[model samples]
Target chain A: MHKKLFIPGPVDVKEDVLQKMATAMIGHRTKDASKLQRDISEKMMKLFYTENQVLLSTSSGSGLMEAAVRSCTNKRAAVFAVGAFGKRWYDMAIANNVPADLFEVEWGTPTLPEQVEEVLKTGKYDVVTVTHNETSTGIMNPVGEIGEVVKKYPEVIFCVDTVSSAAGAKIEVDKWGIDVCITSTQKALALPPGLAICTISQKAYEAAKKVENRGYYLDLVKLYDYIQKKDHQYPSTPSLSHMFALDYQLDKILAEGLDNRFKRHEEMANYVREWANKHFEVLPEEKYASNTLTNIKNTKDISVKELNERLAMRGYTISNGYGKLKDKTFRIAHMGETTLPEIKELLSNIEDILGL
Target chain B: MHKKLFIPGPVDVKEDVLQKMATAMIGHRTKDASKLQRDISEKMMKLFYTENQVLLSTSSGSGLMEAAVRSCTNKRAAVFAVGAFGKRWYDMAIANNVPADLFEVEWGTPTLPEQVEEVLKTGKYDVVTVTHNETSTGIMNPVGEIGEVVKKYPEVIFCVDTVSSAAGAKIEVDKWGIDVCITSTQKALALPPGLAICTISQKAYEAAKKVENRGYYLDLVKLYDYIQKKDHQYPSTPSLSHMFALDYQLDKILAEGLDNRFKRHEEMANYVREWANKHFEVLPEEKYASNTLTNIKNTKDISVKELNERLAMRGYTISNGYGKLKDKTFRIAHMGETTLPEIKELLSNIEDILGL
Candidate 1:
C-alpha cells in the first residue's frame, strides 16, 4: 500500500521529484558533476538566504550537525536543547570529544533569547548550537531573537539546525548571524532523504582551521577547502541522484517564489492548528508552534498506534510522538509539497476515524 | 551526450537499477522502513559472505573507512598505502587524531604480506588498514595473503576497503579474518554514488566500545546498536532511493550467481588486459592487476586528453590517471553491470580514435 508520509521527515516527495532520483549516474570527477554541484550550491544559497559557502554531504542532517559542532567548536560549546533534536547536538558534541555543556528547557517550550543571553555571558564557550525548529516538540525556537543575543558574543560561533524548517520558514542565515546553518533534503526542501545541505560562514571556516581532529569524512575545513580548490566538487563521492533532483526541485521552488512557498506552509499550519484546537490541544506553546509539523496532545486519550493503523488503512499515515512523547502525543506534518487540499483530506479522514 | 562511464566508480547503472531509485519515499521511522532495511541487511550478508553484521551509511565508502579507523583503532594504526585510496585511510586516522603510521609502496606496487607481517611483528599497532583494490593504481592488493599474515596478529583489527572490487571480486570476509570490510554502492555494487555498506565483526565492535570520539553520524558502534535495537534501521535517515536500487540490484547480482559474476568480471579483465598488453603496458604488476579496472601506461605517448575527447564525442568516457598520474596513464573500468560486448565496443572506439 502507498501510505502517504506525514512524518517529520522522509515526508511525501512528489512523483516528479522522486523520478529525478532515477537520473543516470555521472562520473564524480567530471565537469558535469562540478557544474551540477555548483548549480545546487548557488540555488541553496538563495534558499538559505545567505551568501556563505553552501556545501552538500551525502548523509543525513546529523552528519553536518556533527561536522559543525566538531569543526567550529575550537574551545568549547554551549548546546541548547528544547527537545530531542536539540539534545542530539549535545550528544554529537560529546561523541566527537568537543567540550560542550547542554541546557534544556521543558519539552514543549522554546529556547528563549534571555536563556541564550545568560549562556553567552560566560564567554567560555567558542560555539553555541541551537535547533531552529524542534521536530520532536513542534516548537520553533525564536532563532531570530536568539541570533540577536548571539551576535553580542562575537567569539562564539552560532550554529543553527533548520532541518525541519529551512525552506518552509524564513531563516535569514546572514542577517541572523548564523555561522553554520544545516538542513537535510527530506524536510522543507521536499526531496528524498539522502543529501545534507549547509552554509558555512567565513567565521566558521576560520574557527575550523584552529580545531584539530575534525575527522576526514565530515571535516568542514577539508570540505570547504575541496570546494574552494576544485570549484564545487566534494572531497568524496556525493549522491548525484539527489543533487539532480535537488537542482530540479530548487527550480520549481523558486518558480513558486520563496514568499509564496512560506505563505503556503503558514496556511497549512494555520489550518492544522485550527483543527487541533477544536479536537485536541496543541503540544507546543501557541506562540512558537512549528509551521512544518504539528504535535497535538492526545486530549481525547486516543491510542496513537491504533490511530496510525486506521490512518494507514485509509491510505495515509501520521507520526506517533517522538521518544517519550509517543502515545501521549501524535503529530501531523504538512511540510514539503503537501498541498492545502491534501492536508484537509488528511484531517477529515482523522475526524471520521475518531468519530469527532 | 549520454556518455557511458568507463570510470572506476559512478559506473553506468542499468536502466532497471536506475528505475529502482525512482521508487516512492517511505517514512524513515516506520515499520515499512525497518522491513526494507532488514531485507537489505539480510541480502547484504549473503553478498558479503559473512555472518557478521552489515551496516549501511548514506555517504560514500570513505565514510565507512573513516568510521572503521576512528572507531576500532584504540592504541595505534598501521596504514598500508598502495595508492591514493590507501593513503586516504592513513589521512583519516590523522584527521581523527588516531595514532597511526603510513606504510607506502610505490604507486602501482602492491602491499606485500611480508611488509604486513613486519608491521604486525612490531606489536605497536592495534588496527591495520589496507585497500583490497586501489582504484588509482589499478592494483588489487594480495588481501587474501595479507589476511593470512594478519590472522597471526589476533589482537589487531583488520580493515579492508573493497570499494572498487566488492561485487566483481570474491571476498570472503569471514574466511579472510577481516574485522571491518567496507564498500560503496557506486563501485562493483553498481548502484549509484551515495550509499556505503560494510560488515563489522564482533571483535571490531568490542574494540569500538573502548574507543572514544567515534563521532555520531559514522559511529560504527551506534550504527550496530541501532540495528540491533530497531531491527535494521539506521541511527539517522538513510538514502532511501539508493537503498531501493541496492535492494533490487543485490537480487540481480545474486541471480547472476556470485560465481558467475566473478567469472564474468575475470573474463572482462582478461580481455582488456590482453588488449592493453598488445598496445601498451599495464600500470600495476601483472600478477597484482585489478580484475575490475585496468590502468594502462601511456607508453605510446599519445594524447590521453585528446583520446578522451574523441571518446566522449562518440558517447564513451574513460578516466585519465588519478592525481599525479594524469595523462601519464589511463584507466578502463570493467566492473559493475558492464558486459563483454560493451568492453569490446569501448576498446574498438579507442582503437579508431588512436589509430592503433
Candidate 2:
C-alpha cells in the first residue's frame, strides 16, 4: 500500500501533478523547451515576490546552495546555522575550498538578526547565508530583520536557503534584500523531488563575476549569461519532465492564491503546534516555529519507529527526528497541499495509536 | 502533437516507461528509497559491465562529467576532444580551476588510441578524459582500443563520457579500465532527462581522496561515503521519480536482452547509414560511424529546417548539425527504442518531402 507522505519533502504530490511527470519528452534545446522554462521562471518570480532572474537546475536544493557559496563568496562566507541545513551551507563552502565560518546556535533556536549583524561587522565575510526555515529544527529565521542588518553591509551579499519554506511562506526576496534565494520542487511546492530553483539578484551575479572558479554545472554567472544568450535555455539538459510538472503545479498554486496557500500552511502548522503542546510539547519556541513543518519534542519519549510502523499500517508516514534528534523529537510536516483537517485526522490517528 | 524526439537526448520514451515517472513519492530517507537506488545501481553495474561502485546524481550527464574532472584530477588533465561534448569536459575543468589542456581533433573525427598514448607518454597528465561517442559528430571512438592504451598508463585515470552511448553500445567498463564512465537517462536509456549515473572505480576514489577541495553536491567521494554509511541513501535528496522510472526501464531493457537491444540499435543505425550513404553521404568515415545516430552531409544543400517542418507534420523530427556544422549536415538518431522500420519510415518521409 502507498503511504501518504507527510514527511519533510517528496510530499504526496496530487494525482494531476504526478501525471504531468508522464508527459512525453521534448528536446531541451528546442523552442518549446525554452517556452516551458520561460513560463516557469515567470511563475517562480511570483512565488518569490522578486524581479530577480530565476535559474532552474536539475538537482536538489543542495546543488544551488553549493553554487551560491562557491560562486558569490570572493573572500569568506558567514553561514548562520540554526540547524543541520544551515550547517550544510558551511560544509559546502569548506568542501569547495571557499573560506567560511559557521555560527551555530542551539538546534531548536533561530538565527537572530543581531547575530547576523555581529558577524557582518567583523568584515571577515563578504557573503552571508541564512536558512529561512531550517527543516531539521523547525525554526524559521527572521530574515526580514536580518536583511535590514545586511543592507548596512553594502559589500556583503545576503543569500538565503528557502528550500523548505518557499511558496508555503511569504518570502519577499526584493524587500528582504536576499541576493540569492534557493529552493526546490519538493518540500512546500508539493511536487516530486528533482528540480532546484533560485532567484538571483543582479548584485549576486556581480559578486559571482568577481569570484573565479565557480565550477561548471552550478555556476550562477554562466547560468545567467547562457539563458540570455540562448533564449531562456540552461547550460545542460534540464529535467523537462520536472519542468512540465512544475509549470502545471505553479498554475494550480496561483489559482489557489499565494495568500490563501500561506494562510492554509499557517493554520495547519498552528493546529499541529497546539495539539503538540497539549499532548506533549513543541520543540522550537512557538514564536520562532516554522509554518511548514513542526518539530515536536517527544516529552512522552515514545518509540517513534514503532509509531511510524503503526502509521504505515494506517497508510500514512511522518518523519522521525533528523540526526541527533532521532527519537528525542519527531517531525510532522504540514506544508504542501496537506489540509488542516487532514492534519487533524493524522493527529487523531496518532492519539488513537498511542493512547495520548 | 508530440514530435518523436530524434535529437541527441530527451528521446521519445515508451508510454509505460514514462508512466513509471508518475510513481508515487517515497521519502529519500526511507529503506524503500535505498532499495530503489540499490536495485538501480546493481542493474547499472550490469549495464556498464563493471564491479565498480555506481553513483546516481539528480542531474544531466554534464553534471557527472563535471564531477569526474573536478573530483579526481589532482594533476593536470589531458582532455581529448572529438566534438562539443569533449570540449565541455575541458570547459568543466577550467571552470573548476583545475589545470587542464584540451587536445581537440577535427569535428567528425574520433579521438584515436595512439593520440591518447602520445599524450599519456608526455607524463604531464594524471587524468585523461575522452568522449566515447561524440553526439554532435555522430562518431563513436574506439574506447576499447583506447582503454588498452589507457591501461598501460597506470598513473592516468581514464574517464569516458559515454553519455550518448552506454546502453545502446557495448561498454565493458572493467575491461576498458575506466576509472569513471558517465551516462544519463535521456539518451539511449530512453528515459526522460534528470538523472545521471556513473561508475567509480577504487582507483578513482583513491585519486579523489588525494585531491583536495572536491566541491560538495558533485563531490564523488562524499557521495560514495554517504551511501556506504547510510545504507545506500544519497547525502542529498535524489529524484525518486527518475529512480522509479529508471529501475522499471532497466528491467525492460534487460528483458529485451542487452545483446538484442544493441543489435537492434546497430541494425537501425545501419539502415539509416545505408539510406544516407545512397542519397547524401555519411559525414564521418564509415568505419568510425556511430551505431546510434547517423550524421549525413547535406551535399545536396537541401533546407534542413524545411525538411524538419515537413517531418514534424508527420509526427517525426530530426536534428540539424550542431554548432559549426549547422546547415553542412543533418542528423537522424536511431538510438533508444527506435526500430529499423522506424528509421526506414523516417527516411521514406524525408525522401517524399525533399524529392530525393
i-RMS, every candidate?
0.8, 0.7
Clash tally for model 2: 0
Off by over 4 Å in 1: none
Clashes of each: 0, 0
Best by lDDT: 2
Residues A111-135 of candidate 1 have per-residue lDDT tens digits of 9999989988988888999999999
Query: DockQ for each of the predicted structures, in order?
Result: 0.89, 0.92
* Tens-digit lDDT string for candidate 1 (B1-356): 78998999899899999999989888887777888888888888887789999899999999999999999998999999999999999999999889999999999999999999998998999999999999999999989899999999889999999999999999999998988999999988888899999999999999999998888999999999999998778888998888888889989999999999999999999999999999999999789999999999999999889999999999999999998899899999999999999999999999988888
Clashing pairs in 2: none
lDDT of each residue in A1-356, candidate 2, tens digit only: 99988899979999999999999998888899899989999999999999999999899999999999999999999999999999999999999999999999999988999998888988888999999999898999999999999999999999999999998999999999999999999999999999999999998899899998889999999899988899999888999999999999999999999999999999999999999999988988988999999999999989999999999999999999989998999999999999998998899999999998
DockQ of 2: 0.92
TM-score between candidate 1 chain A and the true chain A: 0.99
